[model samples]
Target: MLTRIVTGLALIVLSGLYWLQADAIPQSPMSGSVGADGLPKLLALVLCGLSLIFVVQSILVRQPLAAPGIPEDDQDEDDAAFTRRGHVLAGALLAISIVYSVILPYAGYTVAMGFLLLAVGVFYHRRMSAGIATFAILGAVVFHLIFITLLGVRMPEGIWPNVLAFLHAHTA
Candidate 1:
């Protein structure tokens, strides 16, 4: 509970900082009514709200009645395994994030995002399939349309422009 509260407080501070940074973004004439800062500000608010809820939920939840009696002997082993798994998963996710950032500029948003989704999905599901591939492709396309086409953000073109040029030439 103390940890949860502390984490929530830290998140609140982080969200405040994020909101300030978002507020600092310069206004552009090309921006929509919501402006470029809209999304970041909204995200910061959402994070703060979620953190508050987390802190409250942690405080309200009662401790597990001392397991109703004597604890099982495997408890320590189970905790150790759980902690180890958590660390491994955290490390794996961090590695994925780093790779995504490194590749984003060269791969373009669509391709890099697809790779991120596929990699994360495979990591969690522990398997790969046609379904995952389709999801990744479709997800990337949808996100590309939302952020680039609709929002008009100037994301990296990377290898996609060349591919698109070749395809258009062949088709034409």
Candidate 2:
């Protein structure tokens, strides 16, 4: 709980700094409705809100604070279990991330990110479900729109470009 609160507070500070820097962005006459700093400021605000929520949620959970540098014999069951599980959980996340990076060029950003999200969801929930699948797909689509459509970044195409062209031609 303390760790969560501290992390949240740190994030809140980081977001505030981000917002201040974003505010320095100059407005352009040709800028659209959102403007140059719009997305950055919005992201900072969202980060601040999330950080506040994290701090509040951590406080609400109210876990007993564990003392640091406790002797191995004095360590509690919860701490031991968490320590034991941390390696496995971190390993799973790292392995999945490696796989994502390896397959990204072949799978494309959208598909690879969707797979990553799905894998993370499964890791956290310990099961596969329709809701996780939907979230992964929707999240991937939103990311694709933000990076590819709005920002006009050139990502590894794999099959996406061909697929998009086919859809566009058919729709037209």
Candidate 3:
């Protein structure tokens, strides 16, 4: 299938990039045994290997490569069930990701993620009260668990951090 071909090509490109960058990475201060580029290089090598396997499998199987499934020019009644608004919502979600990336460092992960969640809920026609409540709790917990706890990445301390500090001071 065309997907396999694209995946193979992408893997090849990624492997090349990793191989090229492996030599340029500086030594990591936290882990002196491994360089900064070590993880990427390993990932690239794995991707290359997997891609090669896929390519060979496709060839051996003799399966004809086909492009992604595109619907015929005639719009079916089932297709009409999906509204333009659905597409708009999808586009909005994508835009929110782009905006979140830009705002994350300055606004902090919690705030940016909170706003993104609320925006998505609103786009999908959820009520404001329910959306805000869900967004606040879910966004904060998920982002914290993923980026802070699991990934061991430090997120910026924006307004929410100050609010937490204030609460702690008051409680103590």
For every model shown, what is its TM-score relative to the native structure? 0.49, 0.47, 0.43
**Highest lDDT against the true fold, candidate:** 2
Q: Which stretches of candidate 2 lie over 4 Å from their true place?
A: 1-82, 160-172
Better of 1 and 3 by TM-score: 1
What are the per-residue Cα lDDT tens digits for candidate 3 across 100-131?
78887767877777877777667566667775
Worst 10 residues of 2 by lDDT: 69-78
Clash tally for model 1 = 0
- When sorted by lDDT, best at the front, the candidate numbers are 2, 1, 3
Which wins on lDDT, candidate 1 or candidate 2?
Answer: 2
Q: Per-residue lDDT of 33-114 in model 1, one digit per residue for the tens?
A: 9999999999999999999997887778644335657564234655654677788888999999999999999898889999
Q: Which regions of candidate 1 fall more than 4 Å away from where they truly are?
A: 1-82, 162-172
Worst 10 residues of 3 by lDDT: 65-74
* lDDT (Cα, tens digit) per residue for candidate 2, span 9-118: 99999999999999999999888999999999999999999999989988886854456954433356767546657878778889999999999998899999999999
- Per-residue error for 90 in candidate 3, Å, reads 4.5
**Each candidate: RMSD to true structure?**
10.8, 13.2, 9.9
lDDT-wise, the better of 2 and 3 is 2
Q: Which predicted model would earn the best TM-score?
A: 1
